[model samples]
Target: MPHSIPLIRAAAITPIRRWVEERGEDVGPFLARADLSWVPADDPALPVPLRSVVRLLVEISRAAGPDTPHRIVNGRGGFEIGLIGRAAFRGPTVRDGFARIARMMPAHCTHEIFTVALSGDGLHIRDGWAYDLGDDEALYLVQQYVASLIDMICSVAHPEAPRAERVEMVPHPEAGLNHLRPWLGDRLQPAPLRALDFLVGSDVAAQRFPKGAQERAREANGETGRRIASGASLADQVSALVAVMLPRTTPHLDRVAAAAGISGRTLRRALRQNGTSFSDVVERTRAQIAVDRVRNDTDVSLGSIAADLGYANQATLSRAVRRWTGQTPRSLRSGLKSRIEPGKPVSETRLSK
Candidate 1:
């Protein structure tokens, strides 16, 4: 019997698509082969099946060449950080950056974990997965994710900031050195370990960037952290799906269930066991999204916010906000206006009843 397939963030496979397109090869067929033809290629937060992603990589590697994985993750895009990653890569020191990435990654991707550890030798940034996938495909993902981390560090600091003493990944028979050597040089090595590690030097780890704290990145991190802390319950998953689909359309139970790779009845039962319902999840999701947009994004008008959250009109959104936060949308925005004036610390700005 096939074990349950794990859901990963849709952004996880974006680089592969971009790489294939850049090489003049059609990515549609590869996506179809992996049963991902229905996934919206642009939406990064939508959940996708991990098994399908692995199969898609395997098929692409078979056609493109042994170096496909390394070539695709050339560290040019630095997209792995997503919204939360902006704050993660902006930490005081390289060590703090690694620690922040490890903590915040769960909000962007599931069935995978990142760890940062300090040993006598050096600081280690590692990737571990919860799903059982083929070695070659798994190695492909590790290669991409590990390189993206280095790229994220370079994005905030200098290109030569992250000095890796050594890099290690699980050994694969088809893995080639031609492409990896140009990037990692002699530091890339094959090992029996299941995870990939980038062992960094002490000096590089402690090196700090010039730019101080950024308010936008901090707010993004805080919001994502609260969502991830809600746990991986069915309700939380449904809520996340609703949030992603809100701007597009009303995320019905069946549509969300299909995205989750389950039936609506099954999802309903699971949520019931967890003490929640579909309507409850949707309402809560809309309330939170409305508040966040109203409080932080001043450029977006109330009507636009209402439309994005699937509200029928501004009055409906105002009522929902009042019920959720004990304040109308205008009141919440007005409360935050003064705190956002020039020279006011963004950290002092808070939306309250």
Candidate 2:
């Protein structure tokens, strides 16, 4: 069952409208288009179909300016945070690279929570949140858009280098992983569950972007401005965190409420009054993840994957999977094959600094 729409926000309206206008065929399911009555493009509230917009911006930024080797952040106010990484942390050290990422891209860059990790194999970045509660289309667009941005970064950073690295996210179920593998070739992860593995050498990891890039990426308004204009209400907070963080971790009542900076009791009462429950919402999300995982990857070993989820063993994981899909992992992956989509260059869009 689909989650019913909540009270739409004035802030989210413009992005919703732009999404419907530009790529609704691809981005329609999860996002609700904005009501024109709320705001027009003339208004600061006018949002673009941002996932698409950001992807396009990253693509342009990859090709923009001189080949000075800079990092681009998907900053707010209609533009990318171009090359602030090089300026922010000036060194060819993993610490500098990470500091650059931390300074520039906090979780919720463009309204989503993203985490970056350094695994032994590569730089593993995970993006998903139970917040940003639009619709499935908005979620899908955001996911795909992030993946493309990752791809653009790798292309510009490594160029034709074979052993450099690649970036990707866990994609939608219907579209398979073959496409990413083709573009990234040996660099791509073997599974849809592949995290953003930027396999770089110690030297590249230490290398920082150009000078002055960090300050340029810095937004003028501070976190206070973000809070004031955020348009998040007490109630919307619960759903928002659920939308973003839920994808990263299992959505427990306490966890969801905590993300909203609210009490679990208050969250339960709110959801109850609103005709839903935390458990119901979590189960729904889990169901979606289960189906997507099952339908998309034949190679994602269920037994070993039990650990990917917070399961002690396959039995615990299998129980939940069966409840959602009415099929065991063996049955689910039996006839499964992956999917792919044609790669297209996103349009050029530049924002004022």
Candidate 3:
């Protein structure tokens, strides 16, 4: 069987609790419902189920009303930047910090993937889901996440640093614009994708953190990363590696083992210890990448997706889709397309089984 996706660190919810209470709303019941037991001050590092975090946000929004999402997210700024934030702040330069955060996001929040890329005149930071947040909640969640990122960037950035030139999101109603204005200002614009652009100067990117702060932060982050990796079984690591490799080439045990810095025999021994095989990891990785691409990228055709996954043809992909999802490739594609329609409920799009 494929390994279960990792849970998100509890620190992700710290800001929510803080903002909710600041609004004078009782958060105890909701936290209990979400099964969260600690506050931001507690500095809890325990991982919580991603569904529970989503549920907590949904429940908080319901209780606090529709504007709560914007209010809470904006009010807290980047106070709840989580583990990724901590590690990033410890880096020597702003660019280095942002890069580190992007790399560490997968270990912290496996439900979404983030990328920082350089555009012609500026840097474009894009975010896409590894799992669906559904349509009803997607906008608010996306806003909250993107806003938090903007806040983090602004906090450490020099006064002369690159300003956020543009902020884009899936089209949303005009009502929420008020809450976003303080952070995003006039830069907010509607786009087909979710991304933020920063016009950073070389000096800004090179600005160093305070003396010894970067080193201490890096050490702490390294320890945290190690702990996170140490918790995963060897099979889980191989599966993650295979997932990343599938888009570029067919992942083999030897390559995977080399990537893991182990001999093939040792890799086999590790997997056997974990009660799995190399082939099992490959299938699970392919199955995961297939579903993710299908659900997230509507413009990409089935044949193209199959080719990316190293499938000989779309027919093989269709068969594999049927086996994995109990639905044909066309049907799966249709469901994904339908979910992307504006105002449609997104409860049906599930990545975790």
Candidate 4:
């Protein structure tokens, strides 16, 4: 019999698998229970029933505590490493990015529809699901989707990242409230799940990407536009230096600036001209290096890999790997290909110190 339930892309739940493994538990039992054991680890775009995925998340949450959903979606990379994020970041502004994501999201998951609106000088985002999965499953799914959406918006905005002034979420237990308070803070209010909502300021949301088109053209013409007549692109140069320095010490802005024979302020200005911040470059460098090492070097211990990548320990690197690839290091080393891609230079160049 053909089932009528909506389907979510299998890629959407890889993070859940990584989380289960990170806790030192086997994923076979969980996948077996969800009837998802047949889903190939290598195939990301395969479809699985949305109800099954939500139930799997709810099951994990029950086993791991309410924080599982938050941890899965609230990580640094969020959805930007995925397909929708690549298309969205290529947009002209933060608000445009949201629109692109809203339009393209259905191709990734059918259960939810994303809507973006302008309310005077602010932006309102709403996530409306096609069908209810009941309270427990709905709560976890809402957290996973909504948090990823907010993080995607903020990441595209970069340094001028807009703050979510008000957010309304489905009612939760007090323990769940505590887990969420750190991220949503005082802006959170209990509301029905008709639609999950968030509001962000217009100025940052409307900040134009002055260099987006030019940079994209340049990258297409050359190999990532690594060079110019005078020297390498400052951002590329800084990334190279950071990658080299990761194993030795923290690539602090001041230290990296000195290595590049420029003052910290001057280096910051150069990177800003290239449409990135010091922290952003460092983050990209770390993600690229981490993915390369994990995918290519199966014999390397994760602890060693973490130390080489400047992470404090294996567990920290594991979380970062999960965020970047939606899979754990072991999973990646064992043959799961990373689905992350580097986003375009979409951040607006800011002059303010």
Candidate 5:
């Protein structure tokens, strides 16, 4: 399953910059490394973007903690940086530090971080870091970070797990260069996307978290998420839920519940416990998603966009847009677009005929 798509991808990158500053490093080292073979940020040959891959490596490194090497790339536009750091270790039974990386990862990375959650009792992680790194040093740093995260996850796992979960490097044909079967008896997959997969027992995970910690974990770094959502404001809960499921038509409560694995009643109860109602949720989400999407994606045509949002006609869509966001569709588009393109009228609809 796709692990929290937005969080994983949205990690804060400041730590990477801080890490780089500490090392007195330059992008040159990555270019000089002989062992590193990288595809460019613009490489069309691969399915994933180099910058994104680099971004993941950096998040894992920072989450691993301090005193580790770091690497970064400066693409002309929208490029990313990387860093490597030490892993956190706690508890004797959880001997593998790598497993802890997997466990704690949700706390450190963003919602959009590249992650493929394997379904199993225990997790085995393999990893890959992408770069247009023309140098071996940068690539090596990426490799070490990947290896360290795997090590962290494995160390935290229960000593004897019944089944294993395979995680491999995204860029590898058979996981990563460390393809050899481990003597330690890990069940590793030599597949690309599984490189970061870990062998973790869900039962153990249940026991590891503190009371209410998982929910807290979910809220961590999630600045946009609501705190205790239900009764406070139906509009707010609906807004938050829609934010979580935008661009995908119909933010059905049941679907949200399924994504969260909670029953509709229970989900409603939790929302109520916090402060809101289900009807409020539906309205808030629909309104917010509509406004956000219309303002955010310029490429989508107005009519198609309206239809995707379940509006019967452009006029109804326009009215609803006005209700949610005190502005007409044209005004909304222009205002939002102006932030990205300076001086150009932000809204596409020219007000004067």
Candidate 6:
């Protein structure tokens, strides 16, 4: 059985849409090309295909010409201030806000995980996810996400409180680096991982917002979190858990069942009721992760990706990639590279798996 990849909130792409529209570019064709009917303005919580959103970002980049990413970042109007944003905004201090954002990210987007850690004199905010995007798409997403994050922090915190000192992104060509430097500053360092570091000023952690704001935000976030959790089906929960676990090891059905506080039989019954199986979810997740790594993480070798995904070896992953994409691992990588280059027409790049 094959399971469809889960959809993400349409609100995630709101920034890109707004940027394009502000530039006098009609966003309709881009949305249509990404298989989206309309941009959901009324219901920001509405779900849309994640791949489509990725495709839209790539298309927008192509249309906006050189240094498009910088323009998009600078053009960001404001944060949407959803449940997570509200919780962060209501926090007593900038550090507290980062903590709230970290805690609430999983509830908002299951595919990606975020973490905040204190380094010597600064704080590091790391974004981790099983790669499920091509090179260009991944770069666009990371850039957009980091920019929005910094913008949100700056918007809520005191003007001088939380200043980003540096950002680390996956390595790219000189052209990409040139575009990134203006917004990210010359402090940008290309690395094998994705993260952004902020220089926590002395005033950040102790600065407090208006009284009662924290309580109100927390109450609202609690309700939103509960609604999200309650509405999620067992299979959805299992799939999210599997995604988190896949990077470390091949998750077993029994282990996943236990993690969900259900027996194996019960887990199987729940999945069957949801019209899926454990194996189907696992295969789909692995396939998605493999493709992402192959297309984005050019630094990681095939054997390393196979091991990360719990395959026996590179040969096994090669076979799996072929079955999933109707192309070999090498061919898929090559094709994506050719399709993602700057100046390439959007129609040449298909989002379909």
What's the number of clashes in each of the models? 0, 28, 0, 0, 61, 0
For each candidate, what is the lDDT?
0.64, 0.41, 0.60, 0.63, 0.40, 0.59
Task: Provide the lowest-lDDT 10-residue window in model 4.
Answer: 222-231
Give the alpha carbon lDDT tens digit for every residue of 39-144 in model 1.
Answer: 7776765666566777787888778776666567655534443544554556767678778777767765566777889966457888777665666655655555
Query: Which scores better on lDDT, 1 or 2?
Result: 1
Candidate that scores best on TM-score? 1
Please give the distance, in angstroms, between residue 20's alpha carbon in candidate 5 and its true position after superposition: 39
lDDT of 6 by residue, 1-353 (tens): 22223345556666667777787878889877875544454555654445566667777766665456546655332345355656576666767777777887755654556777776534566765543455744564555565555544554455442256666666444355656565556766665555433444445544564445566565552225422331256666666656655774446787566544457887787777777777776666666778778877877899999888778889988877776666777787775432222111121111111
C-alpha TM-score for every candidate: 0.59, 0.39, 0.54, 0.54, 0.34, 0.57
RMSD to native for every prediction?
9.8, 22.2, 18.7, 21.7, 16.8, 18.6
Off by over 4 Å in 5: 1-183, 186-241, 296-299, 334-353
Report the C-alpha lDDT of model 3 over 164-253, residue by residue, as the tens digit.
666666543434554556656777666555433344445555666554545556555322653343235667766665664567545667
**Model 3: how far is 166 from its true place, Å?**
0.8
| Global local distance difference test of model 4 | 0.63
Give the residue spans of candidate 4 off by over 4 A. Answer: 1-3, 78-81, 159-162, 173-176, 207-353
Instruction: Give residue 89's lDDT in candidate 2 (0 to 100).
Output: 32
lDDT for position 289 in model 1: 74
Q: What's the C-alpha lDDT at position 8 in model 2?
A: 20
Candidate 5 accuracy as TM-score: 0.34
Regions more than 4 Å wrong, model 6 = 1-4, 73-78, 160-162, 171-174, 194-223, 226-353
Ten-residue region with minimum lDDT total, candidate 2 = 344-353
Best by lDDT: 1
Residues 126-241 of candidate 2 have per-residue lDDT tens digits of 66553443343234434544444443343333334442465444443444345445445656553344333344544445444433433434533312112212224333444443
